[model samples]
Every structure is written in structure tokens, then in C-alpha cells.
Target: MIVFQQRYPVAFTIAACLVCGSAVAQSAIEHHVWQDKRKFEPYSRTAKSITGAIRLSGNPDFATPGSKMTMTFGNGKKVGLTSVGASWRQWDETDDKKATAEAFKLSRDPGHLRNGNTLCGDPQSDPAQYVVFLERSTFGDSTRLLGMAVFGSKEVPHDINSQSLCGTFSYSTD
Candidate 1:
């Protein structure tokens, strides 16, 4: 197991491998976000805002083809770009920053549907592009699946669940 703590961002990341008997079977990533209310203390432990875990296991023989699973919180909120019907290359990867930038531009092309501040695009017509832009502005550098939270609050974050997509994409509040 490996653990890394970042001070400024108040993030704690844990990477570990699971072993059954003598052989390792799976690896997991656990991330925790903390909100500090201390002024003098730099490393003050505070209330935890979120906790996320990603685990991968099983063999190809037992794995289902074309199967995909998106992460969701205990509050019934979906996490990561996949939740918004976007791919890793289109949103988080450093190698595909160009594609990510292009998607941000096209999202505000004036033809896309708008729900409050978010921009909704057609995932079919624009493959690799963001199907749902949470906000009208450009995507942030720090914004990624690991660092993002959706529906984290008791109040509805946005109307994306109610707004119609390009008909190819669908979202649910439940």
C-alpha cells in the first residue's frame, strides 16, 4: 500500500493491492477530500467532504465484452466524465489536451442546448466531445474524474438530469 498527502489541495490518495491467500487479485485507488477551517494550522485535519474508490479485478475469460461501469457516490450521484457520457481522452488525459480544448470551444457554438449555465452537445455527432459541459466556461486544468464531484450537495446541482440531450444521451437524477 502507498499513501500520498497533498497539503494545499487537502487531498489524500491511497493506492493498494488486494491479496487473497497468497496471490494478489486486485488493485484499488482511494481518494479523500477534506475541508479545513483552520487559519494557523497548515495541516489541520478537518471534515471530510468526499471519498472515492476505484477497484479493478477479474480475468478476461470471465469479463463481459463491451461492458462499462461508471462510479457513483453513496448519495446516488455519478462521478467522472463517463457519467456525463464523455471519454477519458476527451476530458482528463494530458496527451489529448487538444481534443479537450476543441470540445470546450464547440460546446459553446451557439447551437447547443443550454440548461442554466451548462452546455449540452450531441455525443453521436461529436464523437470524443463532451456530451455535457457542466458550465458554459472552458474546462479547468484541475478538473478531472479523480478530482470531480457530481450531485455532492443535497440541492440539485444542475438541471442536466431534466434537460433533454441530443436524444442519444440520457441523464437521471435517480
Candidate 2:
């Protein structure tokens, strides 16, 4: 029989392997909207708001022991633009976004979204999006995300389980 330490070089190796396996076998994405804001009239003084959170369970095959498993957003293909911003580029990549929390604050700033007249198109309509990234690693790093906890700007009850009228959410597994 092999000793416990001798059997498993790293105490958490088994747990980490199991976690990575689960992600590979059944990866999933859950986007929960906690707040949302929109406006049909750009010139309007105020705008509707929507906020939400996203959870991802992904497994990147062939990842090394010390490699990283980060969740990054794809760049826009059309117009040769690669970015996750609300600009003149097509809206393809604008839908699926991920970035550091600090980057998302640019949109959540009350004053920024309030300036609806600076819309890309359709002066009568304005849309804004704010998404934050959550990273996981194969090196036994864990992120304790208990679903998304978005705060509603309205005075309504803080029903975390309730869905908001935010953008569409899609879930897929590999």
C-alpha cells in the first residue's frame, strides 16, 4: 500500500481534478439580470436600467497543471474591430462580454448612461451593457460565486431569484 502523501503529490490534486473534470463533462453558463436600463427616447432626461450577473463553468482541455483558465470575451469580427465596447462596431460581440469589474463601472456610472444622446445610432433609442469577468484556474483556484447578485435600481423588493427584463441570456455546454 502507498502512503497518503506518497499517493497524492498534492493534497488537493484529487479535488482539483474532480472539479476540472466536472467542468469539462458538463459546462454551463447562467446569466442572471439584477438590473437593467433602457430608453426609447434618447433626449429623455432619465432612462430605464437593468443589472445582472453571469456564472460560467468551463473546462479547457489540454490545460497544464500550472496553466490558467480565464473567461475572456471574443472580439467583434465585422468591420475588423476587436473589442467589447458600446461603439460603432457591429453588435455581434457586444452581446457576450466579460472583463474586469473596474471596466464595467464605466457603464454603470449614473452620469454615463444618463448621457443617452451620444448613442451610436437611432437617436431615439439608447442601450448600455456592463459585464464583469470571473476567472477560474486549473491550479486549484476557486471562485465562490453563489449565482449573480445584481442590485435593482428600483425600490422594489430584492428578489435575487426573480428574472429581469434585461438582455437575452443563452446557456451552452461543451
> Tens digit of lDDT per residue, candidate 2, span 52-139?
2122223232212222222211111111111121222112222233322111211222222222322122322432223222221112
- For residues 5-39, could you state the per-residue lDDT of candidate 1 as single tens digits? 44422333222222233265344432111111111
- Clash totals for all candidate models: 0, 11
Note the Cα lDDT for every prediction shown.
0.23, 0.24
Residue 61, model 2: Cα distance from true site in angstroms: 24
Runs in model 1 lying further than 4 Å from the true structure: 1-22, 29-90, 97-174
Runs of candidate 2 exceeding 4 Å displacement: 1-73, 77-125, 131-164
Question: How far is 12's C-alpha from truth in model 2 (Å)?
Answer: 31
- Per-residue error (Å), model 2, residue 81: 19
